[model samples]
Target: MSDHHIVFIPAAPHYLPTEQQVSSAKAALWQWIPEAEAIEAAVTEYVQFHDCGSNFEYVRCHVCGQELTIPQWHLLMEQDYDLERGFGLTPQTLPCCGNVASVNQLDYSFMQGFSRFSLTAINPRTGAVSAQQTELLQRQLDHPLLVIYCHV
Candidate 1:
C-alpha cells in the first residue's frame, strides 16, 4: 500500500502559528483542499521532514543544467543536515560540472523541511493542491505557506 501526505509549512522558518491561527488555518485548509482527510495542525520544537518516497525523480542543477540521477540525489539527501538548527541542504560543488549547487537550485517538484507549525492533510487523493488555492489560503491565514509532499 502507498500513503501520501501533503504537509503545509510556514514560508518563513521562524513563523509559528498561534492557537487562534491554528483554528483559522484548519478552516482554510478544509475550504481549499477539500479532499484532505484528518486535517490537523501541529506545533513542533524541531521536526525532521523529508519526502522519502514520492513521485520526484531527478533534480536539475541550476549552474550546469545537468540532471542528478536518483542515486546521486539520494546521496545528497542522506547527508546529515539538521533542519532544526536552521541548517538545510548546503550548496555543494557538483560532480557533473563542478559548480556550486543546492537543493533550492535544483529543479524538482516536491517540498521537504522542518518548521515550528505544520498544517497537514493525510492521504489527499487529488494529489497536490493548486498554487492559487494555497495563495488564497496564505492570504487568509496571513502567513506564507510551503506545501510539501511526503510518503511513508
Candidate 2:
C-alpha cells in the first residue's frame, strides 16, 4: 500500500563502546541512561549518515498496540550476508502481503527510491517501529528496490 512508502534507516552495524566512553558520556550528557543496559539500547541503533542526532522518536498504536514507527530494522538475509549476530536483526523480507496489497513488494519494482514517502506513526507502549513510518531517505540514494529493499 502507499502507506508503506517511507524508508527508515536501520540501526548501524554492531559497535560496542568501552566502559570509559560510556561512563564519560554519562557524566557529560544530560539524559545519560544511568544503567549500562539502558545505555546499550540506544548505542546500538541503526542511525544513518543522513540522520543528524542519535536519539529516535517512536509511538505505539492505540488499536493493535504494535510498533509503527521503526527508524530502521535489519534484513536477516542478504546476498552479502554474514553470520555474526547483532542487536536489531530482522528477516530479509518486505512488510507486504497479508490484507494489504503493497506495491513495494516483490511484484512491483522500486523506482530508484524516488516516489513518495509518508511519515510513520509512533507507538508508545513498546519501543517497536512499524513499516508505515517512512520519509524519503534521499534522491541520490535511489535504487531498484531490490538492492537495499529492507536495509533502510
Candidate 3:
C-alpha cells in the first residue's frame, strides 16, 4: 500500500447515519476515494487508539495479513456532548467504522481537542513490525491538518 497520512478528522457518533444507512454510507465513502488503506481489524484498533493512543497505525495480527488503517482525530465530540459548541470545529466528515452515523461534508479546523494519535503499520500476518510500512505511515501521521490520505 502506498503511504497515506494519518490525519485527524472532525466527527462524532451523531454525524453518522443508522443501520439502514451503512450500505449507502460505505458506497459514498468509496466514491470519495480511499482516504487511507487498512483492514477491518486495523480500523477497529485505530478507533480504539483514538480513545487513548496506539503504538502503530496498522497492527499486524500474526494470523491475518490484512493491514489496518489508523484513525487519528482531535476535537472529539463525545456521544452526549453539545453539538453547537463544536459546530464549526471540523475539517471534514470522515467514514464512520460503525461508531459514527454518516459523512456528509468536509470541514477543516486548526484547533485541537480530545485525543491525538499516530498510525503505524502492524503485520497482522506475524504480529511483526514492518519497518518499511511504519516509515510510510509515519509520514502520513505527520500531516496533522490533512483532509485525507491517498488510499493505497
- Report the lDDT tens digits of candidate 2 across residue range 40-120: 113322311222122233323323334433431122123223344322233233332123211121221221111222112
CA error at residue 137 for candidate 2, angstroms: 24
Clashes of each: 0, 22, 26
Q: Candidate 3: list runs displaced more than 4 Å.
A: 5-10, 13-17, 34-152
The lDDT values for all models are: 0.69, 0.25, 0.29
Tell me the spans in candidate 1 whose CA falls farther than 4 Å from its real position. 33-35, 80-87, 111-116, 149-152
Clashes of 3: 26
Residue 59 in candidate 1, Cα distance off native in Å: 1.9
Model 2 earns a TM-score of 0.23
| Model 2 misplacement above 4 A | 1-13, 30-91, 97-152
TM-score of 1: 0.70
Candidate 1 residue-wise lDDT at 105: 52
Task: Write model 1 residue lDDT over 1-152, tens digit each, in one string.
Answer: 88777788876655776777778778877776687767887876654444535656557777777888877776765563565453364677676788876554566655555466787888777766888878876875678887878786
Model 1 residue 21 CA deviation in Å: 2.5
Q: What's the CA error at residue 105 for candidate 3, in Å? A: 21
Positional deviation of 64 in candidate 3, in angstroms? Answer: 45
Query: Which tens-of-lDDT digit does each residue in 1-152 have in candidate 3?
Result: 43333333323312322333333433433333344243221122122222212222433212233322333332233332344443333333333332332112212222122222222222222222234543433343332221223222
